[model samples]
Target: MSSNPGQEGAVAHHEHESREHASHEDAGIGRFFFGHVPEGVHGGLKQYGLLAIFLAIITFVEFVIILPEDLRGSSIVIAPLVILSVIKFFCVVAFFMHLKFEHGLLWQIFVAGLVLGLIVAIALVLLFGVFRPTPRAFSEGRQQPFVHHVEEAPHYEPLVVPTPAPLGAIAPAPAAGAAAGASPGQQIFMGAGGCSACHAIEGLAVGALGPDLTHIATVAESRVPGQSAEDYIRESIVEPDAYTVTAADEGIDQDFQQGLMVATTSSLGLTDEDVDELVEYLMTLR
Candidate 1:
Protein backbone atom coordinates (compact mmCIF):
# COMPACT_ATOMS: atom_id res chain seq x y z
CA MET A 1 0.00 0.00 0.00
CA SER A 2 1.32 3.53 -0.84
CA SER A 3 1.31 6.08 1.98
CA ASN A 4 -0.58 9.33 1.56
CA PRO A 5 1.56 12.56 1.58
CA GLY A 6 -1.16 14.55 3.40
CA GLN A 7 -1.37 11.94 6.20
CA GLU A 8 2.43 11.86 6.59
CA GLY A 9 2.61 15.70 6.84
CA ALA A 10 -0.16 15.72 9.51
CA VAL A 11 1.69 13.07 11.67
CA ALA A 12 4.96 15.01 11.46
CA HIS A 13 3.20 18.26 12.49
CA HIS A 14 1.58 16.55 15.49
CA GLU A 15 4.93 15.14 16.67
CA HIS A 16 6.60 18.58 16.38
CA GLU A 17 3.85 20.23 18.38
CA SER A 18 4.10 17.61 21.14
CA ARG A 19 7.87 18.08 21.43
CA GLU A 20 7.53 21.90 21.63
CA HIS A 21 4.85 21.65 24.32
CA ALA A 22 7.07 19.31 26.44
CA SER A 23 10.04 21.65 26.06
CA HIS A 24 7.99 24.65 27.24
CA GLU A 25 6.73 22.70 30.28
CA ASP A 26 10.27 21.68 31.30
CA ALA A 27 11.59 25.25 30.96
CA GLY A 28 8.73 26.55 33.13
CA ILE A 29 9.50 23.96 35.84
CA GLY A 30 13.16 24.85 35.82
CA ARG A 31 12.41 28.55 36.24
CA PHE A 32 10.01 27.81 39.08
CA PHE A 33 12.53 25.79 41.08
CA PHE A 34 15.98 27.21 40.33
CA GLY A 35 14.98 30.76 39.37
CA HIS A 36 17.24 32.21 36.67
CA VAL A 37 20.60 30.47 36.68
CA PRO A 38 23.31 32.44 34.92
CA GLU A 39 24.98 30.87 31.92
CA GLY A 40 28.08 28.62 32.49
CA VAL A 41 27.17 28.18 36.15
CA HIS A 42 26.41 24.53 36.80
CA GLY A 43 26.17 22.64 40.14
CA GLY A 44 26.81 19.02 39.32
CA LEU A 45 27.67 15.96 41.47
CA LYS A 46 31.40 16.65 41.05
CA GLN A 47 31.03 20.23 42.28
CA TYR A 48 29.03 19.06 45.32
CA GLY A 49 31.69 16.47 46.14
CA LEU A 50 34.39 19.14 46.06
CA LEU A 51 32.36 21.39 48.40
CA ALA A 52 31.89 18.47 50.76
CA ILE A 53 35.60 17.88 50.87
CA PHE A 54 36.27 21.56 51.53
CA LEU A 55 33.81 21.57 54.43
CA ALA A 56 35.37 18.42 55.91
CA ILE A 57 38.81 20.00 55.79
CA ILE A 58 37.55 23.14 57.51
CA THR A 59 35.95 21.04 60.24
CA PHE A 60 39.18 19.15 60.81
CA VAL A 61 41.13 22.39 61.07
CA GLU A 62 38.67 23.77 63.58
CA PHE A 63 39.00 20.61 65.66
CA VAL A 64 42.78 20.77 65.60
CA ILE A 65 42.85 24.47 66.55
CA ILE A 66 41.00 23.75 69.81
CA LEU A 67 43.19 20.84 70.89
CA PRO A 68 45.58 22.93 73.01
CA GLU A 69 44.28 23.97 76.44
CA ASP A 70 45.81 27.45 76.37
CA LEU A 71 44.69 28.19 72.81
CA ARG A 72 41.19 26.91 73.53
CA GLY A 73 40.90 29.26 76.47
CA SER A 74 42.14 32.29 74.53
CA SER A 75 40.47 34.27 71.72
CA ILE A 76 43.14 33.13 69.26
CA VAL A 77 41.30 29.86 68.78
CA ILE A 78 37.78 31.29 69.03
CA ALA A 79 38.30 33.98 66.40
CA PRO A 80 39.60 31.61 63.73
CA LEU A 81 36.83 29.10 64.41
CA VAL A 82 34.20 31.81 64.00
CA ILE A 83 35.68 32.91 60.68
CA LEU A 84 35.81 29.34 59.37
CA SER A 85 32.23 28.68 60.46
CA VAL A 86 31.03 31.76 58.57
CA ILE A 87 32.84 30.60 55.43
CA LYS A 88 31.22 27.16 55.64
CA PHE A 89 27.81 28.73 56.19
CA PHE A 90 28.12 30.85 53.07
CA CYS A 91 29.31 27.96 50.98
CA VAL A 92 26.38 25.78 52.02
CA VAL A 93 23.81 28.53 51.50
CA ALA A 94 25.14 29.58 48.11
CA PHE A 95 25.61 26.13 46.60
CA PHE A 96 23.35 23.67 48.44
CA MET A 97 20.48 26.11 48.91
CA HIS A 98 20.93 27.34 45.30
CA LEU A 99 20.89 30.97 46.49
CA LYS A 100 23.76 31.72 44.13
CA PHE A 101 21.73 30.47 41.17
CA GLU A 102 18.60 32.32 42.30
CA HIS A 103 17.54 35.94 41.71
CA GLY A 104 19.10 38.95 43.46
CA LEU A 105 15.84 39.61 45.33
CA LEU A 106 16.11 36.22 47.10
CA TRP A 107 19.67 36.99 48.14
CA GLN A 108 18.59 40.33 49.55
CA ILE A 109 15.84 38.72 51.58
CA PHE A 110 18.14 36.06 52.96
CA VAL A 111 20.73 38.62 54.03
CA ALA A 112 18.15 40.80 55.75
CA GLY A 113 16.85 37.81 57.68
CA LEU A 114 20.37 36.84 58.76
CA VAL A 115 21.20 40.36 59.96
CA LEU A 116 17.95 40.55 61.93
CA GLY A 117 18.63 37.19 63.59
CA LEU A 118 22.11 38.29 64.67
CA ILE A 119 20.79 41.54 66.13
CA VAL A 120 18.15 39.73 68.14
CA ALA A 121 20.64 37.18 69.45
CA ILE A 122 23.03 39.93 70.57
CA ALA A 123 20.26 41.92 72.26
CA LEU A 124 19.09 38.88 74.19
CA VAL A 125 22.61 38.14 75.36
CA LEU A 126 23.03 41.67 76.66
CA LEU A 127 19.63 41.81 78.30
CA PHE A 128 20.20 38.57 80.17
CA GLY A 129 23.77 39.44 81.19
CA VAL A 130 24.80 36.05 79.90
CA PHE A 131 28.50 36.80 80.17
CA ARG A 132 28.39 38.52 83.55
CA PRO A 133 29.20 36.43 86.58
CA THR A 134 26.56 36.00 89.27
CA PRO A 135 27.36 36.98 92.85
CA ARG A 136 27.32 34.15 95.36
CA ALA A 137 26.33 34.38 99.02
CA PHE A 138 29.09 33.07 101.25
CA SER A 139 26.78 32.55 104.16
CA GLU A 140 23.02 32.62 104.63
CA GLY A 141 23.32 35.06 107.53
CA ARG A 142 25.98 37.14 109.26
CA GLN A 143 28.88 34.95 110.29
CA GLN A 144 29.41 34.68 114.04
CA PRO A 145 32.55 36.18 115.49
CA PHE A 146 35.13 33.64 116.56
CA VAL A 147 35.48 33.45 120.37
CA HIS A 148 38.28 31.74 122.30
CA HIS A 149 36.95 30.05 125.38
CA VAL A 150 39.33 29.74 128.32
CA GLU A 151 39.02 26.59 130.45
CA GLU A 152 38.68 27.09 134.22
CA ALA A 153 41.77 26.27 136.26
CA PRO A 154 41.65 22.55 137.36
CA HIS A 155 41.88 23.46 141.05
CA TYR A 156 41.76 26.86 142.72
CA GLU A 157 44.70 27.45 145.07
CA PRO A 158 43.80 28.02 148.71
CA LEU A 159 43.43 31.72 149.54
CA VAL A 160 46.88 33.21 150.17
CA VAL A 161 47.46 36.91 150.36
CA PRO A 162 50.67 37.97 148.57
CA THR A 163 52.05 41.43 148.89
CA PRO A 164 51.39 43.62 145.79
CA ALA A 165 54.40 44.63 143.70
CA PRO A 166 55.44 48.27 143.51
CA LEU A 167 53.40 50.48 141.15
CA GLY A 168 54.47 51.45 137.52
CA ALA A 169 54.86 47.97 135.91
CA ILE A 170 52.75 49.21 132.85
CA ALA A 171 50.55 46.02 132.90
CA PRO A 172 52.06 44.52 129.66
CA ALA A 173 50.32 47.13 127.37
CA PRO A 174 46.79 45.68 127.84
CA ALA A 175 47.46 42.62 125.61
CA ALA A 176 47.41 44.56 122.29
CA GLY A 177 43.63 45.22 122.30
CA ALA A 178 42.38 41.73 121.27
CA ALA A 179 42.42 41.95 117.40
CA ALA A 180 39.04 43.12 116.07
CA GLY A 181 36.96 40.57 114.07
CA ALA A 182 34.70 40.57 110.96
CA SER A 183 34.33 44.19 109.83
CA PRO A 184 31.24 45.80 108.25
CA GLY A 185 33.23 45.90 105.01
CA GLN A 186 33.13 42.13 104.87
CA GLN A 187 29.33 42.26 105.16
CA ILE A 188 29.07 44.71 102.27
CA PHE A 189 31.32 42.56 100.08
CA MET A 190 29.08 39.54 100.62
CA GLY A 191 25.97 41.69 100.30
CA ALA A 192 25.26 45.06 98.62
CA GLY A 193 28.66 45.87 97.12
CA GLY A 194 28.49 42.82 94.82
CA CYS A 195 32.29 42.52 94.82
CA SER A 196 31.94 38.76 94.86
CA ALA A 197 30.29 38.86 91.46
CA CYS A 198 33.50 39.46 89.53
CA HIS A 199 36.45 39.29 91.97
CA ALA A 200 38.00 36.31 93.74
CA ILE A 201 39.68 36.02 97.16
CA GLU A 202 41.34 32.77 98.22
CA GLY A 203 39.28 31.86 101.30
CA LEU A 204 36.45 34.34 100.81
CA ALA A 205 34.75 35.16 97.49
CA VAL A 206 35.02 32.43 94.81
CA GLY A 207 33.92 34.41 91.75
CA ALA A 208 36.16 33.96 88.70
CA LEU A 209 34.77 36.45 86.18
CA GLY A 210 37.34 39.11 86.95
CA PRO A 211 40.82 39.25 88.50
CA ASP A 212 41.90 37.25 91.48
CA LEU A 213 41.94 39.76 94.36
CA THR A 214 43.62 37.41 96.81
CA HIS A 215 46.65 39.67 96.96
CA ILE A 216 45.04 42.84 95.63
CA ALA A 217 46.36 44.89 98.51
CA THR A 218 49.94 43.85 97.85
CA VAL A 219 49.74 44.56 94.12
CA ALA A 220 47.47 47.60 94.16
CA GLU A 221 50.25 50.03 95.11
CA SER A 222 52.32 48.89 92.15
CA ARG A 223 49.45 48.93 89.65
CA VAL A 224 49.75 52.68 89.17
CA PRO A 225 52.86 54.82 89.53
CA GLY A 226 51.60 57.00 92.39
CA GLN A 227 48.41 55.29 93.56
CA SER A 228 48.26 53.90 97.07
CA ALA A 229 46.68 50.54 97.81
CA GLU A 230 43.68 52.17 99.51
CA ASP A 231 43.27 54.66 96.69
CA TYR A 232 43.47 51.94 94.10
CA ILE A 233 40.84 49.85 95.82
CA ARG A 234 38.53 52.86 96.24
CA GLU A 235 38.96 53.92 92.61
CA SER A 236 38.34 50.40 91.37
CA ILE A 237 34.94 50.42 93.05
CA VAL A 238 33.95 53.92 91.94
CA GLU A 239 35.43 53.92 88.46
CA PRO A 240 35.96 50.36 87.29
CA ASP A 241 37.18 51.32 83.82
CA ALA A 242 40.05 53.44 85.14
CA TYR A 243 42.43 50.50 84.90
CA THR A 244 42.03 47.14 83.26
CA VAL A 245 43.58 43.92 84.58
CA THR A 246 45.53 41.52 82.41
CA ALA A 247 46.74 37.95 82.75
CA ALA A 248 50.33 39.16 83.02
CA ASP A 249 49.44 41.59 85.81
CA GLU A 250 47.57 38.94 87.78
CA GLY A 251 49.84 36.05 86.71
CA ILE A 252 46.76 34.21 85.47
CA ASP A 253 45.89 32.04 82.49
CA GLN A 254 43.56 34.58 80.86
CA ASP A 255 42.95 38.31 81.01
CA PHE A 256 39.69 39.67 82.33
CA GLN A 257 37.41 41.16 79.70
CA GLN A 258 36.89 44.91 79.94
CA GLY A 259 33.43 46.50 80.40
CA LEU A 260 32.12 43.39 82.17
CA MET A 261 31.96 45.20 85.49
CA VAL A 262 29.09 47.56 86.28
CA ALA A 263 29.93 51.02 85.02
CA THR A 264 29.05 52.80 88.26
CA THR A 265 28.66 52.11 91.95
CA SER A 266 25.11 53.45 91.67
CA SER A 267 24.18 50.54 89.43
CA LEU A 268 25.01 48.19 92.29
CA GLY A 269 23.10 50.36 94.80
CA LEU A 270 26.26 50.84 96.79
CA THR A 271 26.38 53.85 99.10
CA ASP A 272 29.62 55.60 100.06
CA GLU A 273 29.80 53.58 103.28
CA ASP A 274 29.15 50.39 101.37
CA VAL A 275 31.95 51.19 98.97
CA ASP A 276 34.28 52.06 101.81
CA GLU A 277 33.49 48.82 103.58
CA LEU A 278 34.04 46.86 100.36
CA VAL A 279 37.37 48.57 99.81
CA GLU A 280 38.48 47.89 103.34
CA TYR A 281 37.51 44.25 103.12
CA LEU A 282 39.21 43.78 99.73
CA MET A 283 42.39 45.48 101.02
CA THR A 284 42.55 42.88 103.77
CA LEU A 285 42.63 40.04 101.20
CA ARG A 286 46.42 40.08 101.41
Candidate 2:
Protein backbone atom coordinates (compact mmCIF):
# COMPACT_ATOMS: atom_id res chain seq x y z
CA MET A 1 0.00 0.00 0.00
CA SER A 2 3.04 2.37 -0.40
CA SER A 3 2.31 5.78 -1.93
CA ASN A 4 3.50 6.67 -5.42
CA PRO A 5 6.96 8.36 -5.56
CA GLY A 6 5.42 11.47 -7.26
CA GLN A 7 2.84 11.92 -4.45
CA GLU A 8 5.56 11.54 -1.75
CA GLY A 9 7.72 14.24 -3.41
CA ALA A 10 4.74 16.64 -3.54
CA VAL A 11 3.93 16.10 0.21
CA ALA A 12 7.57 16.74 1.21
CA HIS A 13 7.68 20.01 -0.78
CA HIS A 14 4.48 21.24 0.89
CA GLU A 15 5.88 20.50 4.36
CA HIS A 16 9.14 22.32 3.51
CA GLU A 17 7.17 25.40 2.34
CA SER A 18 5.26 25.52 5.63
CA ARG A 19 8.52 25.37 7.60
CA GLU A 20 9.99 28.18 5.47
CA HIS A 21 6.94 30.36 6.13
CA ALA A 22 7.28 29.94 9.91
CA SER A 23 11.01 30.72 9.75
CA HIS A 24 10.27 33.92 7.76
CA GLU A 25 7.76 35.05 10.38
CA ASP A 26 10.30 34.48 13.17
CA ALA A 27 12.99 36.37 11.22
CA GLY A 28 10.65 39.32 10.70
CA ILE A 29 9.84 39.45 14.42
CA GLY A 30 13.48 39.30 15.41
CA ARG A 31 14.60 41.95 12.92
CA PHE A 32 11.78 44.45 13.45
CA PHE A 33 10.99 44.04 17.16
CA PHE A 34 14.46 43.34 18.49
CA GLY A 35 16.79 45.32 16.27
CA HIS A 36 18.59 46.82 19.22
CA VAL A 37 19.56 43.42 20.67
CA PRO A 38 23.13 42.14 20.43
CA GLU A 39 23.94 39.47 17.85
CA GLY A 40 24.63 36.64 20.32
CA VAL A 41 21.12 36.77 21.83
CA HIS A 42 19.21 33.63 20.85
CA GLY A 43 15.70 32.26 21.56
CA GLY A 44 15.92 33.63 25.12
CA LEU A 45 14.68 37.03 23.89
CA LYS A 46 11.07 35.97 24.58
CA GLN A 47 11.98 35.79 28.25
CA TYR A 48 12.92 39.48 28.09
CA GLY A 49 9.36 40.37 27.17
CA LEU A 50 8.07 38.37 30.14
CA LEU A 51 10.57 40.07 32.41
CA ALA A 52 9.56 43.54 31.22
CA ILE A 53 5.89 42.84 31.86
CA PHE A 54 6.59 41.38 35.30
CA LEU A 55 8.73 44.33 36.31
CA ALA A 56 6.10 46.77 35.11
CA ILE A 57 3.48 45.03 37.25
CA ILE A 58 5.78 45.10 40.27
CA THR A 59 6.43 48.81 39.80
CA PHE A 60 2.73 49.50 39.60
CA VAL A 61 2.11 47.53 42.79
CA GLU A 62 4.84 49.36 44.60
CA PHE A 63 3.37 52.72 43.65
CA VAL A 64 -0.22 51.80 44.38
CA ILE A 65 0.23 50.07 47.73
CA ILE A 66 0.18 53.30 49.71
CA LEU A 67 -1.51 53.37 53.07
CA PRO A 68 -4.97 54.82 53.36
CA GLU A 69 -5.13 58.33 54.77
CA ASP A 70 -6.92 57.10 57.89
CA LEU A 71 -4.61 54.15 58.51
CA ARG A 72 -1.38 55.89 57.57
CA GLY A 73 -0.50 56.33 61.22
CA SER A 74 -0.52 52.56 61.83
CA SER A 75 2.42 50.14 61.47
CA ILE A 76 0.97 48.01 58.65
CA VAL A 77 2.71 50.05 55.96
CA ILE A 78 6.15 48.78 56.98
CA ALA A 79 5.41 45.05 56.67
CA PRO A 80 3.96 45.34 53.19
CA LEU A 81 6.86 47.48 52.02
CA VAL A 82 9.40 44.96 53.30
CA ILE A 83 7.56 42.06 51.69
CA LEU A 84 7.26 43.91 48.41
CA SER A 85 10.90 44.83 48.42
CA VAL A 86 11.86 41.16 48.89
CA ILE A 87 9.60 40.11 46.03
CA LYS A 88 11.07 42.77 43.78
CA PHE A 89 14.58 41.71 44.71
CA PHE A 90 13.86 38.08 43.85
CA CYS A 91 12.26 38.98 40.53
CA VAL A 92 15.19 41.16 39.53
CA VAL A 93 17.69 38.49 40.55
CA ALA A 94 15.95 35.65 38.78
CA PHE A 95 15.22 37.49 35.53
CA PHE A 96 17.37 40.56 35.10
CA MET A 97 20.39 38.98 36.79
CA HIS A 98 20.04 35.90 34.58
CA LEU A 99 20.14 33.65 37.65
CA LYS A 100 17.26 31.56 36.34
CA PHE A 101 19.31 30.44 33.38
CA GLU A 102 22.61 30.26 35.27
CA HIS A 103 24.33 27.03 36.34
CA GLY A 104 23.03 25.37 39.50
CA LEU A 105 26.30 26.08 41.28
CA LEU A 106 25.95 29.80 40.58
CA TRP A 107 22.41 29.88 41.97
CA GLN A 108 23.61 27.98 45.04
CA ILE A 109 26.34 30.54 45.60
CA PHE A 110 23.90 33.42 45.30
CA VAL A 111 21.48 31.84 47.75
CA ALA A 112 24.32 31.08 50.15
CA GLY A 113 25.44 34.67 50.06
CA LEU A 114 21.89 35.87 50.68
CA VAL A 115 21.46 33.56 53.65
CA LEU A 116 24.81 34.55 55.12
CA GLY A 117 23.86 38.20 54.84
CA LEU A 118 20.60 37.55 56.64
CA ILE A 119 22.34 35.69 59.45
CA VAL A 120 24.81 38.52 59.94
CA ALA A 121 22.08 41.14 59.86
CA ILE A 122 20.01 39.31 62.45
CA ALA A 123 23.02 38.84 64.71
CA LEU A 124 23.91 42.53 64.60
CA VAL A 125 20.32 43.57 65.24
CA LEU A 126 20.27 41.41 68.33
CA LEU A 127 23.69 42.60 69.44
CA PHE A 128 22.92 46.32 69.06
CA GLY A 129 19.20 46.23 69.72
CA VAL A 130 17.08 45.49 72.79
CA PHE A 131 18.49 42.00 73.27
CA ARG A 132 21.87 43.53 74.09
CA PRO A 133 23.73 41.63 76.80
CA THR A 134 23.94 43.25 80.22
CA PRO A 135 27.35 43.79 81.76
CA ARG A 136 28.33 41.82 84.91
CA ALA A 137 28.10 44.55 87.58
CA PHE A 138 24.74 45.75 86.33
CA SER A 139 23.28 42.24 86.47
CA GLU A 140 24.57 41.66 90.04
CA GLY A 141 23.29 45.14 91.07
CA ARG A 142 25.76 48.04 91.07
CA GLN A 143 25.18 48.59 94.79
CA GLN A 144 26.57 45.17 95.71
CA PRO A 145 29.70 45.87 97.66
CA PHE A 146 32.89 43.87 97.04
CA VAL A 147 35.14 43.28 100.06
CA HIS A 148 38.82 42.54 99.34
CA HIS A 149 41.46 41.23 101.77
CA VAL A 150 45.04 42.44 101.84
CA GLU A 151 47.43 39.77 100.55
CA GLU A 152 50.52 39.63 102.76
CA ALA A 153 53.85 39.02 101.07
CA PRO A 154 55.34 36.43 103.49
CA HIS A 155 58.69 36.50 101.68
CA TYR A 156 59.31 40.29 102.12
CA GLU A 157 58.95 42.93 104.84
CA PRO A 158 57.46 46.42 104.40
CA LEU A 159 59.96 49.27 104.12
CA VAL A 160 59.75 51.67 107.10
CA VAL A 161 59.26 55.41 106.63
CA PRO A 162 61.66 57.45 108.75
CA THR A 163 60.06 60.89 108.65
CA PRO A 164 57.42 61.94 111.18
CA ALA A 165 54.06 63.12 109.73
CA PRO A 166 53.95 66.84 108.92
CA LEU A 167 50.78 68.85 109.60
CA GLY A 168 47.93 67.78 107.24
CA ALA A 169 50.28 65.34 105.47
CA ILE A 170 48.75 62.30 103.73
CA ALA A 171 50.66 59.05 104.26
CA PRO A 172 52.00 57.13 101.28
CA ALA A 173 49.74 54.12 100.66
CA PRO A 174 50.43 50.59 99.47
CA ALA A 175 51.39 50.45 95.78
CA ALA A 176 49.00 47.57 94.99
CA GLY A 177 45.88 48.93 96.80
CA ALA A 178 43.78 49.81 93.71
CA ALA A 179 44.92 46.78 91.72
CA ALA A 180 44.26 44.36 94.59
CA GLY A 181 40.83 45.86 95.39
CA ALA A 182 39.48 46.33 91.84
CA SER A 183 41.41 43.67 89.95
CA PRO A 184 38.84 40.90 90.44
CA GLY A 185 35.92 42.95 89.11
CA GLN A 186 37.97 44.23 86.19
CA GLN A 187 39.01 40.69 85.36
CA ILE A 188 35.40 39.56 85.34
CA PHE A 189 34.51 42.44 83.01
CA MET A 190 37.47 41.90 80.72
CA GLY A 191 36.43 38.30 80.24
CA ALA A 192 32.69 38.89 79.75
CA GLY A 193 32.35 42.41 78.27
CA GLY A 194 34.23 41.53 75.06
CA CYS A 195 36.59 44.53 75.54
CA SER A 196 39.71 42.40 75.72
CA ALA A 197 38.35 40.45 72.78
CA CYS A 198 38.41 43.53 70.54
CA HIS A 199 40.97 45.87 72.12
CA ALA A 200 44.55 45.44 73.25
CA ILE A 201 44.76 46.45 76.89
CA GLU A 202 48.27 45.68 78.11
CA GLY A 203 47.19 44.19 81.47
CA LEU A 204 44.24 42.31 79.95
CA ALA A 205 45.55 41.63 76.48
CA VAL A 206 43.16 39.23 74.75
CA GLY A 207 42.24 39.13 71.11
CA ALA A 208 43.23 42.22 69.12
CA LEU A 209 40.13 42.41 66.95
CA GLY A 210 39.67 46.13 67.63
CA PRO A 211 41.93 49.15 68.21
CA ASP A 212 44.65 49.58 70.80
CA LEU A 213 43.27 51.02 74.04
CA THR A 214 46.56 52.20 75.58
CA HIS A 215 45.90 55.95 74.94
CA ILE A 216 42.28 55.87 73.75
CA ALA A 217 41.15 58.01 76.66
CA THR A 218 43.52 60.85 75.72
CA VAL A 219 42.64 60.62 72.04
CA ALA A 220 38.83 60.49 72.45
CA GLU A 221 38.55 63.71 74.49
CA SER A 222 40.22 65.76 71.76
CA ARG A 223 37.56 65.00 69.13
CA VAL A 224 35.56 67.85 67.53
CA PRO A 225 32.20 67.49 69.37
CA GLY A 226 33.96 67.83 72.73
CA GLN A 227 32.02 65.05 74.43
CA SER A 228 33.20 64.33 77.96
CA ALA A 229 36.31 62.15 77.80
CA GLU A 230 34.95 59.84 80.50
CA ASP A 231 31.53 59.71 78.84
CA TYR A 232 32.97 58.70 75.50
CA ILE A 233 34.93 55.87 77.06
CA ARG A 234 31.92 54.65 79.05
CA GLU A 235 29.46 54.81 76.17
CA SER A 236 31.76 53.17 73.66
CA ILE A 237 31.99 50.07 75.84
CA VAL A 238 28.42 49.82 77.21
CA GLU A 239 26.56 51.25 74.24
CA PRO A 240 28.62 51.27 71.03
CA ASP A 241 25.97 53.35 69.24
CA ALA A 242 26.54 56.35 71.52
CA TYR A 243 29.22 57.79 69.27
CA THR A 244 30.59 56.63 65.98
CA VAL A 245 34.38 56.92 66.17
CA THR A 246 35.61 57.61 62.63
CA ALA A 247 38.67 59.11 60.96
CA ALA A 248 41.43 56.93 62.40
CA ASP A 249 38.87 54.40 63.66
CA GLU A 250 36.67 52.86 60.92
CA GLY A 251 35.06 49.54 62.04
CA ILE A 252 31.86 51.23 63.20
CA ASP A 253 29.64 49.87 60.45
CA GLN A 254 31.01 46.32 60.46
CA ASP A 255 28.41 44.82 62.81
CA PHE A 256 27.04 42.30 60.33
CA GLN A 257 27.93 38.62 60.95
CA GLN A 258 29.86 38.44 57.70
CA GLY A 259 32.09 41.12 59.16
CA LEU A 260 34.78 40.68 61.80
CA MET A 261 32.59 41.43 64.85
CA VAL A 262 30.36 38.45 64.15
CA ALA A 263 30.32 36.81 67.57
CA THR A 264 28.43 39.58 69.37
CA THR A 265 26.58 39.10 72.69
CA SER A 266 23.69 37.46 70.89
CA SER A 267 25.97 34.58 70.01
CA LEU A 268 28.61 35.10 72.69
CA GLY A 269 27.72 35.09 76.37
CA LEU A 270 28.43 38.34 78.28
CA THR A 271 27.42 39.06 81.85
CA ASP A 272 26.33 42.33 83.45
CA GLU A 273 29.52 42.72 85.56
CA ASP A 274 31.49 42.08 82.42
CA VAL A 275 29.79 45.05 80.75
CA ASP A 276 30.13 47.22 83.90
CA GLU A 277 33.83 46.49 84.45
CA LEU A 278 34.56 47.14 80.79
CA VAL A 279 32.64 50.41 80.99
CA GLU A 280 34.38 51.36 84.21
CA TYR A 281 37.83 50.55 82.81
CA LEU A 282 37.04 52.51 79.63
CA MET A 283 36.02 55.48 81.78
CA THR A 284 39.44 55.37 83.47
CA LEU A 285 41.07 55.41 80.03
CA ARG A 286 40.59 59.18 79.80
- The whole-model lDDT of each prediction reads 0.63, 0.51
Off by over 4 Å in 1: 1-182, 264-266
Task: Give the 10-residue window scoring lowest on summed lDDT in candidate 1.
Answer: 170-179
Candidate 2 weakest ten by summed lDDT = 166-175
Candidate that would win on TM-score: 1
Residue range 1-286, candidate 2, lDDT tens digits = 2222332232223222222222212122122322322222244577778877877887787667673676554567667767878877876775566554333456667778989999999998788664866555344432434446845544434443233122122211211333465554455434434444455656545344455676676767765376777667655655554455443453453322223333343454556666566556665654
What local lDDT score does residue 198 receive in model 2, on the 0 to 100 scale?
Answer: 51
Candidate 1: clashing residue pairs, number: 0
Task: Tell me the lDDT of candidate 1.
Answer: 0.63
